[model samples]
Target: MRATIKDIAKRVGVSSSLVSLYLNNRPLAARIAESTKRKIDAAVKELNYAPSATARALRKGKSKTLGLVVADLCSDYSSFFAQTLLDECSRYGYQLLIGITHYDPEEEKRVLANLIARQTDGIFYALRLFPADFLKSLNLQNYPILQLSSAAPEFQSMELAREEALKQCAGKLYEYGCRKVVVAHESWANILEKELEAYGIKIVGGRYATTSDDFPYLNDTPPDAVASDSSIYARLLRARCRELGIPMPYLCYSYSLPSDFIDDPRVIAVTVSDYKTRLSGIVSRMIRMLENPKEPVAHLKEPVRLMSLDELREYRCAQLKDPYYEPFRIRIKYEGN
Candidate 1:
């Protein structure tokens, strides 16, 4: 049987109320003598006493639970974000409940309704779709919402610093002597075409097929380098290069590269937005809002960095050897000497 506050109090020859006060760090606890406090601590250690979270929630009339909604839990980006938020919530004495929407707007609505029904203190949305109309219709006065990767004027958000990251990437490509570059996604190509034009590096091809079957055209005309917003497109580019019996060109990735690409020396560089730091800030801000409902809503932007694949490989290898190893500090590379 689990030990209770009464059991620890009895063992320490103190009253249950006194034990409760000390455990909860109440104002009265400060008045207790040092020796008495030490005795109570020793008794708690001996009994292996743990406070009941459910009981405390009932007394306080607040459920210490956080709801996290993701587009897809299977994706590496979502998985990493979810795990980081889960750890942060656990540290703050809150439990996390996850909901996966698979990029469906209706499913997202259902998930949000369920979380609200369950009385989650706050909701963290990491979904792909940002339906402004739906968000505006919801009554969010009671439960605060925070978004990642996307933005909505209705709630607080931690958005990716995309423009700066693109500038850094274009600078790196220019420094590497890339005269012509092929960008994979049309949306990013449109943005980057303009960004790289100033550097005199022409965009040879703005759109390319991501699948193996539609990539034969790359064999006939290969550019100096390839840039992509998605790691999926980057992977396809490398695969197409291999299939054509041609050397892979210098590759620049916008987001986190796939795990398979980390060890492949063909991938020269990648741009990564610091998700851990961004999520930490989000969780802290959400907790503050939950504690004080009158707190002003704010927006946050996470900085992105350009790093070499070789450096990432070394860092990942070291981390794999030691489970307690801290995340490797990113060394940002610039264009000029």
Candidate 2:
């Protein structure tokens, strides 16, 4: 059996109440001698006594645990986010419970419910296909729930404030003489189109492809460039171009590019935001909210920028030195040397 505070007191031959006061670092009465305190400390170590998190939480009315639920862990962004979040949680003396649901909405709901059932103090989510209306049905309106990437308006969010970045991206493309482009990920089509049009550029087409083979040869306007929200899709665009004997430069969001892509110049520009930094910012806010106990609020935005090919290399190269990059495959090569 695990040693309890009672065992420590018994071993020290002292009252449990006296031991409790010392263990909690509560002010002891003057009659409680310094020698008794030292004895209790030694006894605690000798008994291997550990505090009960459940009991402490019951007394404090909040668990020192947080939940992180993501759609997929295979991606670079997810791996980076999970590791950085765990590091942050450890610093705050909190435990983290992670759930990976592979973008399944039903599984997302189940994992979320389990987190709540387990009395997690707060939740950080990055669900691609989460149903906001169905979440409202859970009646978690006041809960400390924060979503990453996009603003749901229903949940307190740390969104990738995209307007500035998109503007810079469009300007960069315009500078490269790209007046027309096709954007992959149709959900972002209208937004990218609006931004590009601001720079007098036009969207020739849009495709939401999951596989390289899903890219179709577009006959409209013969785009000067192709932009994609996913690294995988951007790769497919490059493949399609090469297969057709056409040279093309593409743009991709920096969300999931493995750090190894720092050397690849085929990518023209990146809509860049530091996911680890944004996660840290929201986590600090969430910790404050949980400690103080308040109603959840509306959306919050985190600014992003556009990194040209040269700038992307410099930025990613700097990230290679950060501890967060240890999970990247590049780390294997880095450590091998």
TM-score of each: 0.68, 0.77
**Model 2, span 1-337: residue lDDT tens:** 9998888878889888888887777766446889998898798778888999878886787788899988777756667678778888888988899988877778888999899888888888776525667777777877788777556666677766777777677777788888767776654565777787778877765444444456554433357777776666666566666787776554555543345353456566787777567767977977877776655566777777777778876776676667666566466577652
Model 2 stretches astray by more than 4 angstroms: 1-49, 128-133, 198-200, 205-213, 218-222, 243-245, 255-266, 323-337
Model 1: CA > 4 A from native: 1-61, 177-180, 185-193, 202-220, 254-261, 274-276, 313-337
After TM-score superposition, the amount by which residue 252's alpha carbon in candidate 1 deviates from its true location, in angstroms, is 0.7
Candidate 1 matches the true fold with a TM-score of 0.68
Best prediction by lDDT: 1
Q: How well is each residue in 115-161 modelled by candidate 1, as lDDT tens digits? A: 88887888888754356566556667445888775666667777766
What lDDT would each prediction earn against the true structure? 0.73, 0.72
Which residue pairs come into collision in candidate 2? none
Task: Specify the highest-TM-score model's number.
Answer: 2
Q: How accurate is candidate 2 locally (lDDT)?
A: 0.72
